[model samples]
Target: MRNEIALTLQKALRELYNIDWQIDTSIIQRTKKEFEGDFTLVVFPFVKQARQSPDMVAQSLGDYFQQNLHCRFNIVKGFLNLTFPCQVWINFLKNNYTNTSFGYFATGNSDVTLIEFSSPNTNKPLHLGHIRNNLLGDSVSRILAACGKKVIKVNLVNDRGIHICKSMLAWQKFGNGETPESTQMKGDHLVGKYYVEFDKHYKAEVAQLEAGGMDKTVAEKQAPLMLEAQEMLRKWENNDPEIRQLWNQMNEWVYQGFAQTYQQLGIAFDKVYYESQTYLLGKQLVEEGLQKGAFYRRDDQSVWADLREEGLDEKLLLRSDGTSVYMTQDLGTAQLRYDEFHPKEMIYVVGNEQNYHFDVLKLVIGKKLKKEYGPRIHHLSYGMVELPFGKMKSREGTVVDADDLMEEMIIEAQNKTSELGKTDFEDGKASQLFEMIGLGALKYFILKVDPKKNMLFDPEESIDFNGNTAPFIQYTHARIKSLLRKAADHQINYNHQSFNEIDLQKAELDLVKMLYEFPQIVKTAGEMKSPALIANYAFDLAKEFNRFYQETPIFKETNEQLRDLRLHISQFTALVIKNAMTLLGIHVPEKM
Candidate 1:
């Protein structure tokens, strides 16, 4: 509908006398309710080219519409108020209401996109940070798929590091083989607790060893627990039977726990990339760069990439001991991904703290590889999720555990539903509704904000029943479904197929306008890679739907034909809301 109007005005401008410029129809905005029309196209941009007053441009466009166009038009100052024929809107609603796909399809141009996110270290359970990363990555993959992009979602598990050893050493020294089942705890939290225990015990042990007439350096180097963990890592790296068995056992438990959380959150990946597997990837790349004269080797045999001219300092690609750093592993992953999918685009849905890291990556691609791929590499770096008290600190144990947070949201949703007297639903249905509501709340709360801007998350504020919230939209869907069921019970049919016979009211017009804009909203959100646009559009549709519901009656209307028309409009509105919500990775429950 928006495109139709824009093109209509574009043709009018082109055919107009003394108008030599391309018409800028980009300003076609929905006018306020107080105004006379549904959409207002401002013609002020063409004043310079038209060499006439804004009012003259507007009048000329209005005259063209009245004389040459099928749609009605009016000139309100410098804006063109255009209204479609009543049948145009009715036909649009009729088509959308009956269509299965809601008028969306893949663009047929398939480009593989590798999305990397949720790289959680094994030392701790998933936290709020992981939640944000997972939501963004998962939502992005879904959106890209909706737009015909073949997206491969991958998680680069940071399974090996000092962090992993902390939990392992703690378990070996103090756990006494106390398994997750033996301790009756979730595996990740169980592992995480021992990680905390290791820090306290290691600190006290270091102090005691130092007090026994040992220098700080000697005491630190000779710490028994630390040395034991290092030995464990070395043995595991060498594929020692017993150590490898223990590593597998622990990581399996952690994976089981992670699987539960991911399933609960509706997050899934096509492939998993483990750092332990990919850590050696960058070494050969660094060596290749050196041969190609793209990198310099230090006196101690460390490989360095010179990026100072690019406003970044020299970065060590490989350590003096021939160990790969973070950059090297990334380099290897990129090459490995190219070999696997040869993605036209690679997006890292990492945190904002790694901005400099990605910058160095782009620099390396330009100077070292000298490869210019059309599909751009994007770092979808979202801001850190801060708590009300301050930033989420994992070491201090102030972090919001993702599993616990999701559970709390479900509980909150159940309580709210119960308060609304929604207990009459069947047990299975109630449970499903709760899950939908809870997950929708979580996804909508996260995606509504600009991904790159820092935002405070108040759990109390996050799950709200009103004001651009998930439940509010869910309620709108429920209400529409309820109305449809009622209409069916009353045996009302809308097959008269004549829309011009009924009088068009304000509420009906508002609903029609909102429904007409869904395709435009989908296109805008997809092109910008911003789900917030869809979120906002969903809320706007809900608001307008609610207004129509309150002001107009469908089942109670005197004329069965008019009532059926309104019902079809309501049905189309519900269909659109459902479609938009799904794009944001949210579901609409029939009841809330």
Candidate 2:
């Protein structure tokens, strides 16, 4: 659509200038309704080439569109307004509205891309931070897939480390083999509690031992829980049957808990890579890099990568003990994925804090291969999702658990439904609606912001139904559905029906224009890799449709033919919104 508009304008300009020089028409702008045009073609850039005043260039273009082109045109303050023909826009909306693939990109043009996100440590249930990561990754993949990209969604689980040992130690000392069912707690939350318990007891034990005036290093190393956790890690690494059994059992519970939460939030991944598997791969990569001179060996026998030439400091690739740090595992994962898919691009949908880490990874990969064969690595750095008070702190226990947050949103949705006098819904209908509304609210809230901008997530302000929210869009859909059902009962078909353009008022024309722009919105969102753009576009369309609904009468029109045509348009617009919202990973309930 952008290309079409640009081409048309360029042709008009060429005719106006009567020139043979190459002309570019990329300086078009969207104009305000009150400013007298739908799009403004800036003529200031042409002033030098055309050797004419900006105002004269604008007038000439406006005159060209009116006299030589098929569309109407007007000029305001050295800006040419190109108003597309009503029939052109009407045809665009009708064609797109009737087709199932109206707002999506052309098929067979998708690039193979890998998207990695939602990397959580095994020590705790997912918190608000992970929620942002999950949504961004899932939404990015969806957006790319919508744009006809062969997107591979992956997750790297951080399941091994001292953090894992903390939970293991706590469970060993205090669990007494209590299962999640026995404790009546969600598996991940149950495990997380033990992790917190371990910290408390371990700190106390260390303090008590130190008070006895023992050597600092000896006292710390001999701390009972610390030593036990270390021993457990060693046993686990050595494949000790008893420790492996316990490790697998606990991790199974955590996986089950994560599955339930993911299902509720509508997130999925094509592959799951655990640190237990990838960390060793990371260590192996360090050894390979050292042999290849991609990395250097320190005096302390640690492996290092000097990225100072890349404007980064030296980084520890492998510890003196030959263990992988966070970065080593990332480099290994990149190689593993490339070996698997050979993707044209790899997008790590991580947080802004890891920007520097990815920079190092790219540098190391470049050095190791001595060629730019690392596939296009992009660190999709998103900002923190904060609360009204401040950042969510896990150790402070003030973090919003994803499960708990979803539950709260569900309850709020249920209460809203009841307030709307929807208490008579079927047995499971309310539960179904709760999931849709809750998840929709959660996704829409997050995706509505620019992914790079730090956003505040106030629990109280997250799910308003009256504003530019998921529920507002959902309600618009529900209303259209009800109206469509009524239209069906009345035996209406507007496919062949026609209406005069004279009746197209401002609100009506605004709606038609908004509906016509859905494809462009989807295209822009895909190109920019920003789902928030579509979110904003969806809300804008819904708002305009609602206004049109309040002011324009579809059912009450005296002309049956015209009434039927308007009804068809309304139904089609509703379908477009429903489909667009789905691309953004939002669900619309029938009655919200």
Candidate 3:
């Protein structure tokens, strides 16, 4: 409808002033609530083109629309406010109220986007920081898919490195062959415990050497534990039989642990890449760069890329001993993805800390190596998630475990749900509802904030049943479901009814208007890669529906047309809420 109006205005300009204007260049937006119109057009940009004052241009355009387009307008200074007749809104609702896939665009074969996220290391279990990354990546993938993009979600596992060797060495020396079955602990947690143990003993050894009249730097290098871990990494790189066996065993444990956590969080990946496998590709690329004079070799047998001319320092590609660095592995992974999928865009959903790393990656590929797909690389750098106290350290074991935090959320959900006397749930249904509310709260709270900003996640605050929380929106959906069921029991059939002649109340009209914006909201969210847009849209829609429900009587309305219209409006609002929440990877329960 807005497009039609814009086109009409463009034709009017051509006819009135013999001017050629593009429809897209015209500015049209939804009017503010304080204004008395459905849409507003800024007339200032066209005032000079029309050779008249802003008010005069607005009046002329308003008159044109009122006469030809069936739109009434009010002039507010330089803004021309336009409102359509009641039948226009009524026709909109009648046409789209029952659409199951209202806001989602269907993807075609040509649209392909590959998103890499949740790149977890096998040395530790998933932590709070990992939670934020996984949620943001997963939600962004859903949003993009909703906007008609063919999305391929992938995870790059850092399975082989010095960090993995640290945990392996600690377990070999301190652990007496204790397995996850023997200890009854999660596999990732068991591995993480040894990683912390390695750190503690390494630090003690350094401190002891420092107390023995040795420099701190030299002591750190000479520490027995640190040297042993480095040797282990070298042996693993050489594919030593014993070392390879241990590495495989420990990595399997961590993978099992990671799978459990991913299942709980409702995250899955289409492809998984191991750094150990991809690092060789990077090494090959480095060798090629050296041959092409894009990289230099040092006297110590190390390889480096000189990016100083590009404002970045020289980056190490291969160590003097022929081991690959993180950058090398990333390059290999990027090349592998491009070869396999040839995606239109390759987005790395990494944290803001790696901003410089991705910059170097792109520069090396684009300028140094001269790869065509290098410019397609995008770093979706997001802010960190912090608690009220401060930051979390993984080595010190102070970081919150994703599994533990999810369990706590479920317990909190149970307590809050019981307090609200919503405990009429049947045997197994109560547990399911608790999981829904708990996970919903966690996901929504983290996603509600803009992805570019750091967020403080408060579990208790997020689980509340009021004030812009997921529970509020979920409960609103449940309330509408209950009302629809009641209508069904009372034999109120609204499916075949015609609401074209019914007069919509202010609240009803407001809701229809809000629903009208869902498609645009989805498009904007996908363009910006922000799930917070959908999250907050769901909140606003829910708030509007609650206001409408309070002011309007549905079941008791004596007029059948009015009651049917209200029921259809209620049903449509619920559909929009469900669809929007789904984009955030959140599930709203039919019964809260």
Judged by lDDT, which candidate is best?
3
Give the winner by lDDT: 1 or 3: 3
lDDT of 2 by residue, 371-465 (tens): 35454888899999888889887777779889988898888888888888877777787798887887788888888999998988777764676
Model 3 reaches what TM-score against the true structure? 0.97
**Candidate rank order under lDDT:** 3, 1, 2
- Model 3 C-alpha lDDT per residue in residues 157-198, reported as the tens digit of each score: 989889999999999999999899999999999999999999
Clashing pairs in 3: none
Candidate 3: misplaced stretches above 4 Å?
299-301, 458-463
The residue pairs found clashing in candidate 1 are: none
Best by TM-score: 3
- Give the per-residue lDDT of model 1 (tens digit) for 1-592: 6666666677776787555545344488887778887678888888888888988888888877766556677777788887767777777776677665673656576788888888888887898788888888887777777777788999999888667877887887889888889988788888888898887887787899989988888888788878887887777777889877777778877888899898888888989999989999878878888988999998999889998887889988998988888889988888888778888888899989999988888788667766453135778888999888899887777888898888888888888888878788976998888888887888888888778888788755646767888878988999999998887787876755776666678888887887777776776666676778888889989999998899887767888778888888888888888988888778897766
Consecutive 10-residue window with the lowest summed lDDT within model 1: 17-26
lDDT of 1 at 57: 86
